[model samples]
Target: MNTFPIIETERLILREATCKDADDMYSYLSDKEVVKHMGLEPYQTSTDVLEEINWYQSIRKEGTGIRWGITLKGKDVVIGSCGFLNMQPRHYRTEIGFELSKLYWGKGIAKEALNAVMSYGYKHFELERIEALIEPLNSASQRLVEKQGFTKEGILRHYEYTCGKFDDLYMYSMLKAEFELG
Candidate 1:
């Protein structure tokens, strides 16, 4: 993870996120609909976006995880982001998370970007499992993972505490063997 990987797909580019992405990132993260199930409150200021960007930087330096800012091909504006976090290298596993602007909903951009990221994780990191913890009420996320060949392994009760409360999450996972079969 010394050099962040820039993944290019047919219609999108997943590049290292930078401070310059703060504005575009804020536009979506500040939206209530975008943050509702993300276990986060809508960011109210640029400072919040800075903290988010800093975390992205720290993860890369720490070799813990990496998130690429999602941009449309030929465009620099970051519409959303998708990547791994809570990575456990010793265990050969990590958690996947993503968010998109409401404006990009249903466009299949997420699927394309995730395909690239997940493939990188498996091939480069030699990951055995990539998992997602989706808020129970988020059907769209559940469907996205399902479409990607992830298996639903049932609910994890009170799995995380965020935004001032405990939340249950649906655990979905895709193993290297399963992804190879994809």
Candidate 2:
């Protein structure tokens, strides 16, 4: 499967991530506030970001997951990363995750990137469902998925361990038909 696709939105570009993007990606991944709810510690250095990009590339090669760097239309730096996770063609489903720089928060950049990704999943990948797992306290992520037409199914208790404790997550999903209605 062609896992890495360059998707463009009016204000954003979702392109395959690479080691060259380490510096730009590290700018956000190193911020505690940006990764607080994403179950990852702030990266201590750009080398960590480089390793992460390599891992992302490997997974895309294996057809398991695909992560994209989110860049502004006119900018050359990545402001964030977003993509499909645990892609299961047999089940026609995949989970989505995203993280944006705190500097770009509240600008709707995430929504723009996610919408493009989900549209690709439904149209090109023939996905029947797209899911999101949001920490209970991460209202912003919940709102992002909700705004994209995903319905909250329920909460998964102790869904993930992050920041030294087990965190509950709200499960949300949007079906292909639901996305088409929008």
Candidate 3:
């Protein structure tokens, strides 16, 4: 959309990431454990985080995708991010992705925010499909998408070239007929 969407869930706020979120975003994103499966290197500086946030905004402006800064309902600090990228609206599809702070690990926050965003994307775009390409080693993400009604299509062996190496990714997808808010 021309304007960023702010989605609210039971205990979270999925809003636009601003320069204000640079520190909070940098904190979690810079953690090696957090970015391990994210296909991105651990950010080395706040400038890097801001540039990432800039990419988020640019994608939205270009009508290619959207990303949201994740925070607790009563808090202002960004603890994570989730969004659609590589959007192919004409094809009725988009890629989904998410990452959370190590400090918030094991909380159901990611799942909650994810469901809300999925619901929005389904209706907002009249989407026919939503795709998630996850690193084969990211078991948590595998479980999350499966629980949310996605079906694993297959492994795209060495499908993506990033971080100086080719990586196999598990392709999981939820068709429009299969989408149901959890």
lDDT of each: 0.92, 0.89, 0.90
Q: Candidate 3 regions off by >4 Å?
A: none
Which of the two candidates, 1 or 3, achieves a greater lDDT against the reference? 1
Provide the RMSD of all predictions against the true structure, rounded to 1 decimal. 1.0, 1.4, 1.3
TM-score computed on alpha carbons, candidate 3: 0.96
- Cα-based lDDT at residue 92, candidate 2: 94
What lDDT is obtained when candidate 2 is compared to the true structure?
0.89
Candidate 3: worst-modelled 10 consecutive residues by lDDT? 1-10
- Tens digit per residue, CA lDDT, model 1, 140-167: 9998999999999989999889999999
Q: Residue 4 CA error for candidate 3 (Å)?
A: 1.9
- TM-score of each prediction: 0.97, 0.95, 0.96
Off by over 4 Å in 2: 1-3
The clash count for each model shown is 0, 0, 0
Prediction 1 global C-alpha lDDT: 0.92
Which window of 10 residues has the lowest lDDT sum in candidate 1?
1-10
Which candidate ranks first by TM-score, i.e. highest?
1
